[model samples]
Structures are given as structure tokens and as C-alpha cells.
Target: MIDQLLKMADGPLQDLLSQSGMSGTESTASAIEDTFGSLLKNKAQSGDLSAIKEMFSGSDTSPQSPVIQNLAGDLSSGLMDRLGISSEQAMSLAKTALPLLMNFFNQRINEAPQANEDIMNSVVKALQGGPGSGGADILGSLLGGGKGGGMDLGGLMNMGKGLFK
Candidate 1:
């Protein structure tokens, strides 16, 4: 997931790293990617599927979204911890870059029906612990196996179909 995302980030990590005059920062990007996966996994583990569901469904990618804001904060912390970037610099980078990355996924998820398959597959994989974390049990729990009731996986896939219409 992060691998594909790395490619889609439009070099923001590289550009930001360069701007910070930070050297030997090749792994910074990787760290941020890992952090992203970890955050999603943790969110799922903690039973915050609504946010995750909303995110992949393309129903909420606004910068003001709790999911996006948390992602930004987590990424900012990773930058600060891994690269010694100031809190302000890390925040600036996160605020500047997260929207573009998230909006890319949002657009992909909300595309035409024919185009939805690949992106939805990616989303399913991501939430199925295929990329890092999230799983059938977690989703099942959301779907009545645990917490009682929510849409099924198929519904999740089709969820964005009418959101943009």
C-alpha cells in the first residue's frame, strides 16, 4: 500500500527533505510510509473502523477529517523522531503534503465503475492486513460478528458509487 503511495506522493517527501537541508535522509520516506501503515493498523485494532471505512469509501478526505488530521499528526511525529525535524517543520510538511496524497486516493476510489475495481481491491487488501494491518476478523466484527452491525464488505466496495452523484 505504502509502496504504491510512495510513487503517488509526487516527490513531496524528497522535496521536503531537500528543503530541510537534511542529509542521509533516504530512509525518511520509508519511515513515513511505515508510520502511515502503522497508524491505520492501530486505528483498526482499536476499533475505529468508521473512520477507516469513511476514508477508503472516499466519503471523507477533507483536511479537517479526524482521520486525515491524525494521519498528519502521526506523520509529523515520525518526521520529527526520525529526521530531527522541528515540530513546526514536520507539521508544515504534513499539512502541505497529506491532502494531495489523500485526495489522490479519494479520487481513485470515487472514479468510474470500471476503474473502481483496482482501487477497491487495493483498499480491501489494505484493510485485510494484506499490506500491513487490518483483517477479516476486524471487518467481520464490524459486520455483526462482534460489534453487532455494519455494512458487509461488498457494501463497503459499492459505498462510494453514489457518494459523488
Candidate 2:
């Protein structure tokens, strides 16, 4: 899944990364992608559904959002390590780049139904190995998993209004 994500990132996301002033364009983009992926996975594994829900919930993806702030920090830390840049530079780049990255992921996730399925599986699996947790149920509802139903991310946003509240 992450490989597919990186392949997808090779185009516009890469350009976006370069535009964001990341020092090592190609490597930094890969690192950023990995950081975001790991963030999602770790959040799921930790049963931090609120954070995950907030991220994908579509209310906001800007740097001001708490989830995005954390994402930026994570991306900044990665940039610092990988590019040998200072914290200020890394954070400035992260702030400039994160909304784009979030929008990219949202678009990619919408276009790729399989990614949505994969996420559902990950969320369910991570939430205590499945089924009993609200993560599975909310995810099922979010993705419309059963009964010949599937929804795009926009649809998820609309239904999500009722989901985590």
C-alpha cells in the first residue's frame, strides 16, 4: 500500500514537495510519505480513533488543526533527520507542505477505492484485532463496507457528521 502511495506521490506530490522548499526533493518526499503512513498506522494501533477520525473527518486539514499540527511536527522531525536541516527550516517547510499533502491523500484515497478498503482493514485490525471496537463499526459505516455499498471520501465526510459525534 505504501509502495503504491509512493508511486502515486512521484508526480504532483513530488512537485509540491520541491515547491515547498524541501532540501532533498526526492528523498524528502519519500520520507514525508513514510512519516504520514506510519502516523496513521501508529494512531490506529494505539486505538487513537479520535485523532484518526479528526484527520480524515474532513472538517479541516490545514496546519491549524491539531491533527495536522502533529503531522507537521512528525514531518518536520523526519525532514530534520533526513535532510540535516534545522528545526525551524523543517517546520516551515512542513507547514507549507502539509495541507497539500493532506489534500493529495484525500484525493488519492477517494480515487482509489482499494486504498479505502485497505484503510478499513487496517483500522479494524488495529483496533484490538477487530470487531469488538467502535473503530470497526465506525469504519464500516464510514466506508459503507457491506451490502454492496461503497462511498467516496466526500460521502464519508457527510456521513461522518453523524459518526464521531
Candidate 3:
């Protein structure tokens, strides 16, 4: 299950790594962390009827949507079902895994000699948005979207950029 989740992330992970100057280690770390967050968010939002409908019902009917297909195949079946993960379990797993993943991701970002804000923004948006749809609220909460709190990607990015020559 974890392998499949990792596989699903490979392309995007490579894209971010190549474009953003993140090292292989950093890319793996970011991908793992992001995947963990996505798992939690998807689980939390599993029962949102409207979101589910939107996911299933496309705006256009021009062949099967690859994004939707991957969501169902990789996320819903490969990761979720294989692990038998419930929302609570997913939350618990994320809590345990996030710090480790962040360490790896941050280490790589810090190693880079240059920083690109646009790339950073894209990565942040992708994390916030999850795989296919919905899940933003769940991720926001998991990422510190509470009173006087939110995931401070800006600070991290700035710090990383500063470390570069």
C-alpha cells in the first residue's frame, strides 16, 4: 500500500525535485510527507457527499479523467483499502510520520543553492488541494489551521532561500 502510494507520487515528486533543486533525499521526504497528509485529508473528507459527487460527476464527458482514475485506483484502492485505514487511523499515522517526512524534505530544500518562489507556491497549492478534490479543510486542520496557526510554508521557503548563495 505504501509502495503504491509512493509510486503514485513518483512523477510529481520527480517534477518538484527537478524543477525546485530539491535533492533526491529531499524529494523522497517531501513526497512521503505529502502522501501522508493526503491520506489523512482524504479519509477525513470521505463522507462529504457533495465532494464525492463532484469527484464522480465530471463537468465534461470527454473520455475518462485520468486524475479521477488515479484517485480511485491509487488512493482509494491501493493505499486506503490495502491499509484498511479509517480517518482516525490516518490521522494518527500522519501525526507520527509528519515530523520525519519534514526533516527529510527540509534538509533537501536547505541544501539547494537557489530558491524559486513560483515552484514553491505550486508545491504549496498542490499540498493544500490534495489529489483530486475536496480535502482542503481536512489538510488545513491537520497542518495547523487553528487559532493563530497555519502551515507556514512561507517561513520555511524564505529560510531555505536565505541559506543559498
TM-score of each: 0.55, 0.59, 0.28
List candidate 1 stretches off by more than 4 Å. 2-6, 10-28, 112-165
Model 3, span 83-114: residue lDDT tens: 55665543433333333333333444434444
On lDDT, the stronger of 1 and 3 is 1
Least accurate 10 contiguous residues by lDDT in model 2: 140-149
lDDT of 3: 0.37
Q: Write the per-residue lDDT of candidate 1 for residues 1-165, one digit (tens) a residue.
A: 434444545466667666777554457656665666566667665656544565556654777777667778878987788768899988876775566556655666666453444444444544544432223333334333334224456654553354232
lDDT of 2 by residue, 1-165 (tens): 333333455566678777756556777777666666666556667776644555343344766877767777877887788778899988987787677665555544444433454554545454333442333443544334422234455765543443222
Q: Rate the local accuracy (lDDT) of all candidates.
A: 0.56, 0.57, 0.37
Q: Name the runs in model 2 displaced over 4 angstroms.
A: 21-23, 54-60, 108-165
